[model samples]
Target: MDERHDPARARWAVAGLFFIVGIVISTWFTRIPQFKTGLSLSDAELTVALLAPTVGALTGMQFAGRLTARYGSAPIARVTIVLAPAALLIPAASGDLVTAFVGLLVFGVVDGIADVAANAQGVAVERQLRRPVLSGMHAAWGIGAIIGALSGGAAIATGLTVLQHFAVMAAVTVVLALVAGSQLLPAGVDRSQTDRESPKRTSWRTGWTRRVLALGLLGGAAMLCEGAISNWSAVFLHDELAATAAVASLGYSVFTVVETATRLVGDGVRRRVGPVPVVRVSVALAIAGLALVLLGSPSDIVWLAIVGFGLLGAGLAVLNPIVFSAVGHGSVQDTGSADTAGAAIAHYTTMSYGGVLAGPAIVGWLSGAMGLTAALACLLVPLVGIGLFARVTAAAEPAVAD
Candidate 1:
């Protein structure tokens, strides 16, 4: 291996990529209200616009595995990361629903591809290190999200326009992506060659087996909860709860801050207690957190809702990382080839992104019909589903290097 592919350096570089993704996503999420106002969209119309990204992400995930296999994860990630920030400018500058929809669609496709590539890099690094570091890498994402949310909230308070905030964020993201991307591992490790050399090779069909699908489902459940909160908590606070824009943004800030704090210690916990138990406990905590929000909503107690959001964030912090790590660690039996892992990851990402696609629209439609309170309370359903499927992660074992 090249000195540049040193596990330590690669780990930090991948963390940096994850951090940049987090920043761009959080920056856009924090400005959802601004987008809504700028377009003068109804809740239903906003739901329709949000669906654009979901569609783009699903479309991108279909091709991400092939792209990663053909060109390597690094180059694909580098291009997408640079493109992602630029795409943000589209929606931020949009003065109508059509433009916002188009902008979000482009941004979502780039973001979806970048997401899989970055996680593929993280999985590769973890396999090299032969330890649990995925949780910690994901923590960097939480840290970036916290910073983005706080900065965006402050910018809104100080009279910054959507274009101004997005432009600065985009420039910062592009610079960081180029610098960090240079440190990623070089791409040419072929799975076919590895399979020829190994004692056994997993068939491609193994990547879509029941166990893998179950793990993907668990991951999807987590993403759905996270997506809903990221896209709606601020809206819930600002509009439904009648909070000022600054205070509304704090809901997301508090959530990400607590989530980040949990992730700081998540790796240690995973190594100690193992992934299954951690997931079960996380699901339980998430249920409790959402219950608090449900309880608070009825009483108009903003503080309670804020605290609940914090707990929800903490519960969700480790889930996707754990699922991704499980996939990298040969969670699917006989599926340890590099290509198999990449394919499995693409499948997992597709399922997870489905949740993201459904979340905003579900919240929007339900909130429009019943009420935001009832809409949010519905998150409890999926949290329970996660607990039921927690055992799937236990099947994973460390990858056997080719």
Candidate 2:
């Protein structure tokens, strides 16, 4: 069968890699305390070590566009998946804080490269297939997180050392990535290029540049909501609602499941409601969900958080794809070659990741001082703003070709 008709299969392949990624990233967090104990590192020292991933991600984002352009996304993705497991080994085996920090730094680089490649592939596939398929690709990442969290918990409970658990996960990730790499299309043919005609290139300095920047900022805000939920939802359930271990953990799990399901359905939602209206509706749902989490009764916090996160997921789902699609429009006009579309993907990704790092740190500070409930309440502000911008951006959107 022609690949365009079967893009879902490609998405599934990508999702499986994301699943391994989830295990690698989340499993280590549970082992953080154990690592600190083993390494005899101070909290301040651990905090500095933890920043390795963010720093690495920022650095990787700067060059991923050119790397993907030159080497193609497939090679970068395959290599990253193979190397990601190595990151898990260091902290698991280390007797010193420095080793653990080195592990995280390496993990960060692997994660960053994989992230850029996967998203570039997603955009390329979606444009070729001429449908909104990126959300489902992301939904795979959410599913992977659930798997990671559960696996990590089980390993911890089973008395498996961090090293042992990570080693197992690494082996699994390497095998899966290698298998998936076989199926992925070459980025050159896989990518969308309207024509081979080379047009004058536009720099990121003026004209629609401001608009692109604005879109990036808005995209970053959406990412903040996602990052915040991932990092802090469990803490909120535990401290605010007084939930038990199993019950509290459900906060993130429930959110992830709901988010994944809704995202699978997001393309349909956009097709029926139109992209702008869907975004508006999603933002409203997020507000309601946030309100429910902050003000709902103890019996309902989990369900409320689930609903809010679902709304958050659904609402935020289309933003990234839509933003890239918009950038593709600009690039096509400027460069007369749609392959340059991936550059827009790079720009927006950098912007969104800025929020990915900042969101957790910001909320951690708020939760420390003003409390979790207040931090959750602050999320509503961005949701409301997204609703407003959805209207303006929707009105301004270039006509979608059939």
Candidate 3:
């Protein structure tokens, strides 16, 4: 039952699940403007409705760790992955703002649970592989996003209804989830159980260690940047840069393609340069990219925004993998139980979800008050924070115990 005996299968399964997650999320994001118009909502009204998902995600994060700890990640992943896409149909078919809010709330809860389960599986597979495969697995997600954005754009151009588009996406995701779930390691190989049997169980209190919090903060900032780009890039292009709807969709496609490419090589980069330096450089690139986005909006150079988004995507490519890997490596103290490790990951995930949940609403509010350009500029605060904290915290990563 040891997954290490067949690490290759486990790795592929985990990667595929990550891909499905990406597709589900990106499909919803790329169609946000359509939803707004269909519901006849203002930017601020849309922002308010969007908060429903954040509320659901926060609620789901509270319990996903414990559920994964008790049930094993594969089973939890199978159920949540299936439920996430099915839930998407609700919002896609909604005729009113209230209905959309309810649907998004359901989708968010299931999606959040699936997110935690997938990462747990990824960490487990990485431990079995005995190398830096986490980043490569995350790259699968970027690939999925690229495909989703491009396809969604095409579907819209061809006059596909939102309901019809979501139906197709849900079917595809369900099929992929079933196949990938079957290939994951059996329940006996659960990483959480293994940690629970360690000689020294890491106390609940140590789960809040300063190093863990710092890594969580860094990860949260990175997720915020990603959420901003995913949810707003199309809108930014159409509204600020005066691009057409079809052309605006290409903005997200460009960003995701670059992100996928960067993540494809992220594992090698981390091995050669170490995580801290990688994180520092990545944040710096993001800061520079956002600056270009701000400057390009008014200058009427759409290429600048596209190029800047690509750089931003590249910069964020490795962030989640590095942060998750640090948690796995640092959770090696003899005193730590599998529950302790799960708790640590949950804490980190909660912070990251906070950023995701808040990012779109914050951007919408700011854009309504000022302009989209000024709204995006606020990302510099978190980007700067990532640079300052990346090295110091990553340097403290504990060696994983054999």
* Best-matching candidate per TM-score: 2
Off by over 4 Å in 1: 29-51, 89-104, 150-168, 189-206, 231-250, 300-302, 331-333, 363-375
lDDT of 1 by residue, 27-74 (tens): 988999988998899999999998887788877777776666666677
- Native-referenced Cα lDDT, model 1: 0.81
Please name the candidate that would achieve the greatest lDDT relative to the true structure: 1
lDDT of 3 by residue, 252-305 (tens): 878888888998998888878788999889888888788777777776788888
Candidate 1, residue 243: the lDDT equals 78
Residue clash pairs of candidate 3: 195-338, 196-338, 200-334, 200-335, 200-336, 201-335, 201-336, 202-335, 202-336
Q: 62-150 in candidate 2: lDDT tens per residue? A: 66655565556666677887888786787679878777777778778778777777776665555545566666677777677767878
Query: Clashing residue pairs in candidate 2, if any?
Result: none
Q: What is the C-alpha lDDT of each candidate?
A: 0.81, 0.68, 0.78
- The residue pairs found clashing in candidate 1 are none
TM-score of 2: 0.83
Task: Report backbone clashes per prediction.
Answer: 0, 0, 9
The predicted structure with the larger lDDT, 1 or 3, is 1
| Model 2 weakest lDDT span, ten residues long | 198-207
